[model samples]
Target: MPDHASESSVRPETPEPTGTSKPSRATESKPEGEPTERPESSEAPGMSEAPEFRDAVPSPPQVPAYAQQGRQPQPPNPWQSNRQTTGTLARLRPARPAAIRNATLWAAVATALLSALLLGDGLGPNLLIVAVPAALAAYFAAQAAGRRLRTWSAVWAVGGLALLAVPALRDAGWPTFLAVVSAVALGSLTLHGSRSWLGVFLGSVGLLSSVAGGLRWGMGGVRDRMTGSRGRWGVVFRSTVVAIGLLIVFGALFASADAAFADVLGNLIPDVSLGDAPWRIFLFAVGLVGALTAAYTAAAPVRWDDITIRAGKPRGRLEWALPLIVLNLLFAVFIAIQLTVLLGGYDKVMAETHLSYSAYARQGFWQLLWATLLTLLVIALALRWAPRGQSRDRTLVRTVLGALCLLTLVVVASALRRMGLYVDAYGLTRLRISVAAIELWLGVVLILIMAAGMFGARILPRAVAASAAATVLAFGLVSPDGLIAEQNVQRYRSRHTIDIDYLRGLSADAVPALDSLPEPLRSCALKEIQQTLRTSDAPWYATSWGEVRARDILEKRSANALVANCRGQGSEGGSGRNGVEGDDSYDPY
Candidate 1:
């Protein structure tokens, strides 16, 4: 087979030289080490030469310039990729500190300072400004400490040790300051365990402090922060509108003849303090929570789509019982007050010297009852008779009813104003019958309206509509109190009276009588007597408010005596009054 194949290849070189070329064919047959090829004719029929063997696939082209270099073409493993990603993040992250010692230190220092200030035992309004700042600082510090502190034990020990150092700073009355400082430190430490709860606790504490101290400005800031992230401007705007309405309505309800706008503003903006204890602060907190919660709850349903199903009419067990609840609250308060007056052992001495627990309770009870009843009545009237459907007469009825309500409110306010003046002039402290009679009448009117309006277009609308209506209702019905105006004047008058009258009776025996009076009254009496002894030549005309009022009556007094002197330093062309005159400017200084 090999000889035949080699002969066929050699003969193919030349057709005519086949015999001579056949020698090469002999050489091809005996080719040293090389394998022999068979003749084409001897191969299988119609067979072709086998193709050259090479790699099954071609090599990939070189990577482009933009491609990452120095990496092999390895298939990706999801697990490995994830690990790399996570490792990169781990490297970039910051390490947690072992302990927030600096934060703890600062918190401790602040707490100590507040405690020392509190020790005076007469901190009162004097410490309000400082207490608010202390509370805020403690809140943030707690957040930091939460990151580092691992256990409640550590938190308490650190906070306690910090407070213990309070006594060492004697110059500031560390002992007293320690009490307040310790309270803050402990409270803040407790907040470290849970941030959300911390926010709640801190918010609550801040609220209460604000209320007790009458620190409306401070509280307003806190509320802003809590709700700022909500991105719900409508909620905020509506709440503001409602608040304005509430203030207006409340003002109208309790408007006093002696009320002045300046005094009202002052009351609205408190000096703030914690010395009043946690309870008073709690009330402040409650009022703030009430306002904020009302705002948020009222707005939440409108904005949150998922919660819309729960947003239908407020028809729960709570809604059904609301009318009864309101009535019970009013009656319970009234009954308690009556029982205190008729059966309780409160005497005239107790009333004159200091209000007993029962007296304050009764006062609060009645005030609460009055406010609640009026608010409920407003609600009932709005729900029942506030016009339904899109009929023109309904709108007309609403307008008429609204106007009539406003008129009725004004008339009631006017009557209350006259009565307050009458009581003040006559020195009649008792007011049980007046408040109850007023609330009772208001509640009756409300119940009747609620009964009539139950099945109508739920005329009160939903929360938004209700809020708008309530706001309008409040403005139409309520009036701001001039408690500040009358209180300041009354205090001044009381002091002036004691000064002029008490000193004239100040023989040696009169010292005991002076001591028997309260501290403020005692102080006024002593100061006048001492001054009289020091300046025996002074005339009675020099010490009279009648004289001061006479001078300032036409002059438009600039604040008080000091401000009057300061007026001389004003710009030469400007008048001394500068618009702060009148009763409005009396204590505005």
Candidate 2:
């Protein structure tokens, strides 16, 4: 026997036992490049089974300890796995700061108190007193919420404040109502960081959301604070309770000790009666909800401009351009007719149509207004579906839409001219003046759209909004009732007739113009307004400039005696119809 173990260790690639010895199946199936294994022969050396020989065989790679123990790896804990993700979100978007919460809370309280003290009686200077402080408080609260007052935001804020002045300047119900609505819209835009028209609408939605969810959001913050540090919150609560108790005890004693002090206290504090509690609470709740809504919106403003609306699928050139071209031709035809009627052919057209000037104007004015509005819609839709793959497509869109805008402006002008004719024929009324102003404003908007086509539309939405606001402000400043009264008075001077009943229904804003009328007519026109002024007992803070002027005019002219003496003055030729009643025959709607 040779030293088989030594030989095997030295030459692991040696051939297996030959002849009678059979090789194992593993050795027989082994590839040619692999080393041969030892044969199980009795005469084979026992040292071949030693650790050194066995160690020469290769093994698989090591596995995890758990796998080695014949068990699968344990699943991760779901709660622990989400810790990092939640931590990241918390770090990225923290809650509103305590300072902002406190400031806004105080603002709500102040707004509530001011509302109870200065509002709810009537519309006047007191509106300004209440609105200005509330707006300023909201502005400062927004600043605390980390909103920088940029130029646009500042413009909106200032515009809102200016609109609030309408009540102080004029006493007409419609103008004051419009001012309040516009002011609220602008305030929403300012608080929610909206600059586009779509953003304006979305900001309105955000305002409603804030109103609906603001209380819950505030309570969430309170819950967090109370739960985060109980000891600190408990101490604060006890301190607040003790402070209130001490204040009540000391304040009652001081108030009773001196009559002057009691009077001063009475003046400083609101009179809170059990009977009036519900109304006062309702007013305070309204103010609180408004202030809190603003504060909540400012703290976490929605980026409304970031919302994108996908455009309609673009059409082929012929498909998109054909309808617009036909519409443009129609618009051209209408413009040609309008021009024909406007130029020296008005008499011929009116004669052929068998209609008076007023009838012609009234019949066509409303239709033209609708046409103008629909043309705008058509242009918008055309632009949305216009072909957009080539420069020629862009040129076509600009041409068609621009032509449509220009034609719509002509229609607006026609409407306004017809309104002028109607007003000339039958004097001015609130409806006529308001419609004319709207037509003029629409014309301005069309001009803006045309300019936008030349340049870019990035500023178009805000410009339109600003123009609307400016229109409203200018309308208020000019005093619509006063203008109507003045125009009617001038018409009366020329025609030697007046609608005394129509003028009598006017607000105090028309006092000066009505006061200029001839004796009996003036007395008839000012009768209702004079009685109103005498009966009103609004506080000084709630008195408007229009009211003050009306009172002064009435006192100087001794309008009471004139109105008393004017009995059956209408039959004395001071009041008569200048033309057919325009409102009954012509429905502008």
lDDT of 1 by residue, 517-584 (tens): 44344444334334333443212211222222222322341112221122222112323221122332
TM-score top scorer: 2
lDDT of 2 by residue, 444-563 (tens): 999999999999888888888888888998898799999999998898778655567677889999999999988878888888898898898766666789989999999998565535
lDDT per model vs. reference: 0.36, 0.76
Cα lDDT for residue 255, candidate 1: 52
Q: After superposition, how far is residue 411 of candidate 2 from its true place, in Å?
A: 1.1
Give the TM-score (vs. native) of candidate 1.
Answer: 0.25
